[model samples]
Target: MHIKERLFGKTAGKEVMAITLTNRSGASITAMTYGASLLEWSVPDKAGKFDNITLAFDNLEDYVTHRPFYGATVGRVAGRVAHGSFEIDGDPYQLETNQETNHLHGGNSGLDTKVWDYQTEQDDQEARIIFSYLDAEGSNRYPGNLKIQVTYTFTEDNKWKINYQAETDAPTLFNPTNHVYFNLHGTVSKTILDHQLFVDADRFVELNEQSIPTGRRPDVAGPPFDFRTARLTSQATESTHPQTLQVSGLDHPFVLNHDANRLDVSLYDPQSGRKITMKTSEPVVVIFMHNGASPLKIANNPIPAYAGITLETQDYPDAINQAHFGSIVLRPGETYRSETTYSFHIE
Candidate 1:
């Protein structure tokens, strides 16, 4: 195994660094300190050709100007919070409503936009990069000073693992996830409609027109939402179901039926014979199919609609307000931990 680091660019007067970790099998993943973002995951397909399967910009200027979550670490909370209002221990706190009337992706300046401190480690079997950030208390109007560490591990067997750990000085909400969009065909010009997906979920959180949860957990027994068995992504994207039509694609959070020993999700592209099997400790997986074309270009090619898909394993959005959505509160003296693993292979 080997690791390399290079200067990526300058952002906010701070130098951003890109770290690449490679295993003996010729597979590698690269991450940047800016946003603690993932830039590349190059692996061989059935034909032994390597290609990056994630959506990413070629330069730092584009990432700074055009913001799609694209492989960035999303936090304070991963999804929308209703009206950006929540109470902690009877004290009501209001956050910036960056998205219409909801607080989306931790507000205008979330973890995804920050440059983090990092350290690297490696052994005979694996390589790792740890990215750390300090979220000051009252920043974006959230409580507590949060010290967070995000670790990415690349294994010799082609597994990409993420482990998140955090501690807060006071009561606060903490729910984070990585927003990496994957197009197994290795290019953003190609849509993911042909990819097959399987999600081990029986129900999904229902959202309103504003995309905030309506406190409903609807069963996924029929078309569109059902993914209990592997099915083409087009089966959901091309459907006329109200839920599918509402967002122009699949963007709902499905409550996961978690099993420590079982893989909970799988995505495969038959054309490339590449597959990703995922397992997470989180209770939900938000499946987002890129619903519209991106103005940005990848490798000089225009990004098309449904160019990629995100399997964001995270806690349910707006959990603080929804009684059944569970709690995301991290109080003093408590340690928060979440982990997810994605294994790649040729089908």
Candidate 2:
């Protein structure tokens, strides 16, 4: 395993770098200090031809200007929080309403847009990069001084793992997830609608008109949301179900009943014979297909609707406000940790 680093660009007068980790199998994953964002993931297809399967911009300017989330690590909180406001211990907190009137992806200036301190390490079988960031108290109108560390490890076995750990000085909420859009055929693949997806879930978080959770976990057994068995994206999109009609495609959180760590979701592209297996410690996984028009220009090409899909592994949305959804509160003296892995191979 090996790692290579080079200047990516300068953000806020601070130099940003891109680090690439290469395994023995000749596949590599490159990420940038900005957002600790995944810039590329090159893997071999059934034909043994290596291709970059993750979507990203060709230049740094696009990332700094647009909020596509792309292949970045999203949080302080991953999903939405109703009305961009919440209460803890009877104290109210207001967040930036970057998406409508709700808080999305940790507000406008979240971890995804931050420049983090990163370091690379490697052993005989794997190469890993660790990114560290500190979210100052009241920085985003949120309480608590939080210190977070996220590590991405690539092993010779073609496994890419993300490990997150955080600590807060006061009671706060935290849910971080890598928002990487994947298209197994290639980053420039026209659409991911041909991909087949399988999620080991019997239920999904119900959403309101604004797409926020309604504190309900509806059964998915007979709906288009039922992805317990592999189903083509095209086939799933054809349903006239309310969920599909509202979102225009798959964009809901699926319940994860597995143990702390095990495979819970998988996606396959029959044309290229490429497949990805994802496992996480989080309780749910949000599947989001780029449904509407995206202003992103990735790889110097215009990104259209349904170009790629994201498997955001993390807690449910608005968990803090919805008691039934569980808690995302991180109390003092507690250390929060979560792991998610993506393993790639050809069928």
Candidate 3:
């Protein structure tokens, strides 16, 4: 395995660096210091042809202007917090409502937009990059001083692993995920409708019109919600179910039936014969069939809706308010850790 670093661009007067880690098998993953975002992942298909499978911009200017969250490390909390209001040890804290009335993706200036310090390590079997950031206390009105580290490991066996660790100086909320959209066909011009997906989940979090959880975990026994078995993504995007129609596709958080030894999710594209299986320690995986309404472009071409999909593994959204969703609270003297791994191969 080997690693290379190059100047990506300048953002906020700080130089952003792009670090590429290549394994012996010829698969490579590139990450950027800006937002600690994933820049590219090129892997071979059945024909031994390599292509970038993640949807991302070709330059830093687009990332700075569009803020699509593409491949970025989402943080503080991965999903929406109801009205940006939550209490920590009886003290109520209100965050910026960046998305309508909800606090989406850790407020306006979340971890995804921050530049992080990084360190790299390489061994005979793996290449690793660790990005670290310090979230000052009271930033965006959140409590505690949070020190977070996001590590990406590329192994010789074609496994890309993400490990998140955090520590807080006071009571705070911490749930993070990588917003990396994958289109196995290798291009954003192609939609993921034809890809097959399997999620080991019996239920999914119900969301309101505003996309905040309704505190309900609806059973996914039939139709669009049922992805227990491998099914075409078109099955969900083309469905008329209210939940599917609400957001134009599957954007709900499916509560995982966790098993340390089992792979919890898999996505495959028949045409390219590229498959990715995921295992995570987190309790939920938010499957977002990219139904972006923004006028976006990549390679100077217009990006269509459903061009890619995200499998965001993290704790439940708005867990602080939903008693059954479990806790995301990180207090002093406590350390928070979560991990997710993706193994790639030809089907």
Please report the candidate that would top TM-score against the real structure: 1
Q: Tens digit of lDDT per residue, candidate 2, span 22-59?
A: 98789999999999899999998899988889988767
User: Against the hidden true structure, what lDDT does model 3 obtain?
Assistant: 0.91
**Model 1 spans > 4 angstroms off:** none
Give candidate 2's whole-model lDDT: 0.88
Score each candidate by Cα lDDT.
Answer: 0.93, 0.88, 0.91
Question: Given candidate 3, what's the lDDT at residue 44?
Answer: 92
**TM-score between model 1 and native:** 0.99
TM-score per candidate = 0.99, 0.97, 0.98
Query: Highest lDDT, which number?
Result: 1
- Model 2 root mean square deviation, Cα atoms: 1.4
Look at candidate 1 and give me any clashing residue pairs.
none
Collision pairs in model 2: none
lDDT score of model 1? 0.93
Candidate 1 local lDDT, 24-140, one digit each (tens): 988999999999999999998899999999999879988888878899999899999999999988999999999998899988899999999999999999999999999999878
Off by over 4 Å in 2: 259-262
Candidate 2 positional error at 11, Å: 1.6
* Count of steric clashes across candidates, in order: 0, 0, 0
Angstrom error of the Cα, residue 47, model 1: value is: 0.4
